[model samples]
Target: MNTRKVYLIWFFLFIFIPLIGSAKIDDSHIRSVVQILIYDNYSKEYISSGSGVSIGGTRVLTNYHVVEDIIKQPSRFLAIICLTQNSQSTPDCSYTAHAYYKYGIAGTSAEYQEELDLAVIYVNNKKDTNGTWKSIADLPMSEFSFDSINPALYGYSMTNIQLGDEIQTLGFPDYGNNTITYSNGVVSNFWMDDGDFFKDHDGVLAIGTSAKISHGSSGGAAFDKDGYLLGITSAEILDGNGSFLSGVIIPITTFNWWWEKVLGYEIIDGVGYTTGSISKEMFCKILYKDYDKLHNTCVCPKGYTENSNQECIAGSTPGSDVKIDNSTSLKIDPQLTNRLKGYILLQVQSQGEAWYVNSVDGKRYYMKDGSTAYEMMRKFALGITNSDLAKIPQQGEDKAYLSALSNLKGKILLQVESHGEAWYVHPKTGIRYYMKDGEAAYALMRYHSLGITNADLDKIPEGIL
Candidate 1:
C-alpha cells in the first residue's frame, strides 16, 4: 500500500466522512488547486511556498505577496507552479511559469497589497518533452465525474453573499504535508481593511469567514455551494498568542479593476475586450504619461511633449519653440484625433511588426528591432539639471518629491552627469523605475500595448519626421 493512499484513507475516514452534511466540493475542483513554489538562487532551495487557484487558460490567480520576492529579484528568484504529486509529501514541479503581472509594483506597501492582494502568472502552454509548460486544462486527471467541472472555467459572482452563508476553501496549506486542504465554515462577517494600524482611513471592502486556513493558503479560492468563486483567501486574523481567529477574503470584484487598470484590458459585462478593436478611451486612459491642459489632450511616451498644434513632438526645453501652424495639421478625423497616440501599435498585417505612435505628432515610429527601439527612446530623452533632478526622490524617501513628480509626471528623466541612462519617474508613487534597455522598454510597451487594425493604423503617418 502506498503511504499517500494510506494517508488519504485515514484523512477521509476522519475529515470528509464527518462533513457529509455540509456543502459538497467536487474532487476535480480539489485537483484543480495548485501550489506556488519560490526557489531562491542563493539558498538553492525553495525558501517559501504558497497556494493558488487555476483561473482557466494558462493563468493561475494568486496573492501578489506570494510572489513579490520574484518581482524584486527576478533573475535570482524562480517561481514554479506545481500541479501534480507523484508520491512525496511535496508538490511535483512539472510546470514552469513567469510572473506576468501583480496588482501593485515591487515597493508597494503591504497595506496596499492587503487591500487588493491579487496576481496573475502564466505558463507557456507548450508541452515539450519535459512537459513543463503544459496548461492546467490540458493536464490529465482521474475518472471522476463532476457536475460543472471544466478546469478552465472562471465563474464568479458579482454580488456579495449574505452572512451565515456556508463557505468552503481549498488550498495546499502548511502542516497538511502539501496535500490540498479543504475547510468549511459560515460567513462570519465583513469589513474594510484600510491598511491603517489605528483604523483611521477608509479602504476596500473585505469578507470575513470562519473557515480555517493556514499561512500557505494565501492565494486559494473560497467557493460557494454552487462551485462559484466567492473571493480569494488573502489573509488571516491572528490573536496575541498567534492563535487563528478568522480569515480575510479579498472580494472577486477587485480582480475586475486589476484586470483593466493594471493588465491593460477593458472588461465589459463580465467579459474582456481583447481583440484588435480596443477603444481609444481605454487606450489613452492606460497609456498616457501626462495631460496637455493647454490643448486638452493627452501627452504620451516618455520622450515627447505635446506642442501648440496638439501634436506630440520631441524637445520642449523651457526656451525652445515648438509652435506648429494649423495648416500643417494632419487633417485627421475629429473622432480619431489623438486616439491611437502614445500607443505601441502592432502591424498585424506584416509579421506582427511593432510601431510606437508619438502622442504629440500623432505619427508612428518603426521599432524595427529591440536595439533600435531603445536607441530611439534615448534620442528624445529629457535632460534635467542636477538641481532639478535632486528635487525628485527615490522610494522610501521623503514625500517632498510628490509635487516634483507631479510636475514632471510620466516624463523619462536623464541625470545631468550620468551615463545617459534614463529613468521613468512615476507620477503617482514618486518613485523612479529604471528603463535599462530596449528589452525593458519593449516589455513596458507590451504592457501598455493595444492592438490596431491595418485600416486604422494606416491613418497615422510613419516615422518621427
Candidate 2:
C-alpha cells in the first residue's frame, strides 16, 4: 500500500516537472526533514503536531510557538522526532527530543508572537547493540559563513534573492502524514517591518509567498533555485474575505541572530558536529546538567535539582558530590574546559599546579568504552588506556545500585551503578568510574531528572557479558 503512495508521489513530481517552472527541488534533503509529534503530559496523548528539520547532529529546529506551551511547562509536555522509513510512511526510528533551549517569545502580552518564532531541540541518542551511542541520521548543515572570527554557517541559497523568484518547500503537510509534501511558488512580496505582514506579528522581516502552505507545515524549510534554503515556513496570509492570499516565511538572516545569541557557535558547514554540537568528553565535563546553550554554561533552573549525573530533574535528593580530580576551586573546573583549552593536558605551570585538556566534542558516553576520560590525574593511576577503561563487558541493570560511596564495598562486582550523571564500579578497593555508561545509567538518570519513573532499566542494553 505504501509502495503505491511512493510511486504516485514520484509520478506527480515527474508530471509537473516542466509545468511548475521553478528551482529544481533537491530530494537529497529528504532524509533531513522529519515529522514531529507533540504530546501533552497530563493526557498522555498527542495534542498537536508539526514538522522539523535536523540542523545539527541530534538537533532539530522547529517553530517556537509549536513548542511554546512545552517551553512554559516542559514538565507537562514532550516531543518525539521520528525518522521516516524510506519505503513506508511510518517511522522507522523515533527519539524523544525536548526543547532544552529557546528564545524570542518573551513577554506575556499577546501583541507580537512572530518576532523570533524559532527554537532548538536536543535528541538523546540510542545505545547501539554494543551499548555505544550510535550516530543517528541528521540533515546536512549549510556552508555559508556568518562571522569572520567564529565563521557563519548557512544552507544553500541564491545570492541577493529578489522578489518574484520561484521557491520549492518540503515538509509534512497535515493532509499527508505518510510522506513529505512539496509545493512550488514565487515570492509575491516582502514585509520590511515585523507586523507589516500581519498586525499581530513582531518587528522582523518576513517573506510573502503565493504557495499553498497548510496548517501543519510550520517550521518546514523553504528553498530557492538549486536547492538552496531561503527561510522557514511560518503560516498563511488570509485576505479580508477569509481567503488564502499568500504564505509567509521568516528569512534565514533573522534566524542567524537567534542562533548566534543562544548557541554561541556556527554551523559554518552544514554538518554541525565539528563545533556546533556537543561531544561525549564535553558531556562528562558538563555533567549532563540542564544548561543554557546560549551562554555555553551549566545551569540548573529553579525547582529542579542537578543529580549526580548532572541532569536537571524535579524534586531533590542528597548531594552525591561526584568527584572532580585536580581542581582546588570550582572557578576553573578543569573537567569542563574542552572546546577552548584542549583535551587531556597536564603540566606544572607557574600558577601552582595546573593542567588543561580539551574534553568536549565526541559521541555520548556508552558502556562500550569509547575512550572518554573520567579523571585526569598526575598520571593515569591505572596503566589501562582510556578505551580499556570502558572495554570491560558492562553488567546488567538489576545487579546495579544507586549510591554515593567513599569506598568500593558490598556493591555487586562488575555491576554498573550510578547516582546522577556519572556511573561507577566499586572494585573492593579504590573505585573507578565511567564518564558515562549503559542504558541503565541513562534511564535512571532520566528517571530522576525527567520523572520517567516507569522506565525499565533492565531493557537498557548491557555492554559486558
Candidate 3:
C-alpha cells in the first residue's frame, strides 16, 4: 500500500474509533436519572421501583412497570419520581407524575398481565404557573441494527457497565416500603442470548451485572461509569446460600420499538434534559412518608406532628411537670473536684440532695454506711489529720456544748460521732459552744460555716436544728 493511502486510513480510523467509544453513557448522565415511587392499593402504602434519565427541561425516560398501576388507579396510587444523585448528601427529588403513555401491550393477554412492564410518565411540577403538566426529557436513544449483533451488544455492555462497578438497584420488594433500597455489587458477566429473550419471553438481554435485584427493582435504570443512563436493571436469580447469581439488564435497544411507535421521536445525539429546582417541601413528602402503618408509628421524628403525607409541623412545648427521676447517684471525676464542689454548693442552696460523687465520664462512686467526711477522706487515702478538726471554731451556749475542744477533735475521727449536734468547750480559748446537726450520723457533709449570716440560719426550721 502507498504511504498516502495508509495515512488517510489511520486518520479515519482514529476519528471513528473514538466516536464509537464515546457512544456509551457514563456516570455523570446517571445522576439525573430517577426511580418511580408509587403507592400500592393492596398494601395501602408507598412502594418504589426503578426508571430514569433526565433528558432535558425536567423530562425523564422510565419503564412502564414503574408507573403503570398508578396511572390506571389514580385514587389508589400516587407516583413520586426520584432523581438518583448523592443519596447521602443530595436529597432525592420527587415529582408527582401527571401523565403517562404505555406501549407493547397491544393485542396480547400479557398486555393485561404483568409482563408488558414498560411505560413512560410525565412528572408533575408542584408549582406550575401555567397549570400545564411537564414531562422529563427522554434519554438520547442510540440506533441499533439487529443483523449486526456484536457491535450492538458491545455498545450496550459498555454503556451498561465498567469492570468492578458498584451500582444500586432501586425497587419495591415484597415488604412494600416507599423508600428506595439500594443493593450494590460488581459486574460479573456481560453476554447476549438471542434465544434467551424468547425463552424468558422478554426483551433482549444485552448486559448482565452482579448487582442484587429484588421483587421491586424490575424497572430501575442501570448507570454506567460516568453516571449516565445505560440500561434498565431488571431481574436476578438467587442460589440456595442466599446469594444473588447475576442481575439481568435490558439494553436501551429494547425500548427502541416503543420509542418510535409510542413516543414518536427519533434518537438524537446529546445530553438528557434538566428540570426546574425541586421544592424542598415536595421533595421531603415524596422521599419520606409521614405515616407508617405497619409499625403503627409516625414517620416524623419525636416532638413533631405529622402535617401531611410526608411533612411534619412543630408541636407544643414538652410538659415541664414530666420529671425524670434522679434516683441513681451520679459519679464525679476526682479531677473535677472544684466543679463538684460548686455543684454541691448549688444543690445545697436549692435544698436538693448532693447524694453522690461522680466521675467525669459519669460513673458513680459509693461510700460505706456510717462514713463521715473525715473517715471517707481516710478511706480514700487523703490522710486528713486530727489537728485539722480542732481548728473549726466553737459557737452558741455551754449546756448545748458536749465536750472539750481538743477531745472533740479526736471524737470527730470516728465516723459515727462526726455527724449531728455536739457541744465542745475550747479550754485554751475560754469559750463553750455548740455544733449543728446534719442529715445522718457519720454522713460526709459540708458544714455551714461560722460566717453564714444569721438570716440564713433563721431560714432553717427550729426543730431541724
**TM-score for all models, in order of appearance:** 0.48, 0.48, 0.37
Each model's lDDT: 0.54, 0.43, 0.37
How many steric overlaps are in each model, in order?
A: 4, 26, 42
Give the per-residue lDDT digits (tens) of candidate 3, residues 291-368.
343543335433243443223322213221112244622222223332222111113344432222221111112222
lDDT of 1 at 134: 39
Residue lDDT tens for model 2, 81-183: 6655342456533456655422111111111123357765655444344646432221111211111111123422223666667777867766675467878
Model 1 — which ten-residue stretch has the worst lDDT? 5-14
TM-score, model 1 to reference: 0.48
Question: Candidate 1: misplaced stretches above 4 Å?
Answer: 1-21, 85-91, 100-115, 125-159, 193-204, 261-263, 267-465
Candidate 2 Cα misplacement greater than 4 A, ranges: 1-20, 23-27, 85-88, 101-114, 125-159, 194-204, 261-263, 271-465
Q: Residue-wise lDDT of candidate 1 within 1-465, one digit each (tens)?
A: 011110000011111112223566655566456788788788788877777766543456788788777755777877767664322335555665566322111111111132256666654333446545533222232211111113212323334476777778887777667777788876766664455421212234567777877777878878866666666787777665766667777666556444433232333232321111222233243333353445443454443555443334433332233224544323233234255555567766667777776543456778777687676556434545455566777667774764524545444566533334565555345566566778887666555456677766654556542
RMSD of each: 16.2, 19.0, 30.3
RMSD of 2: 19.0
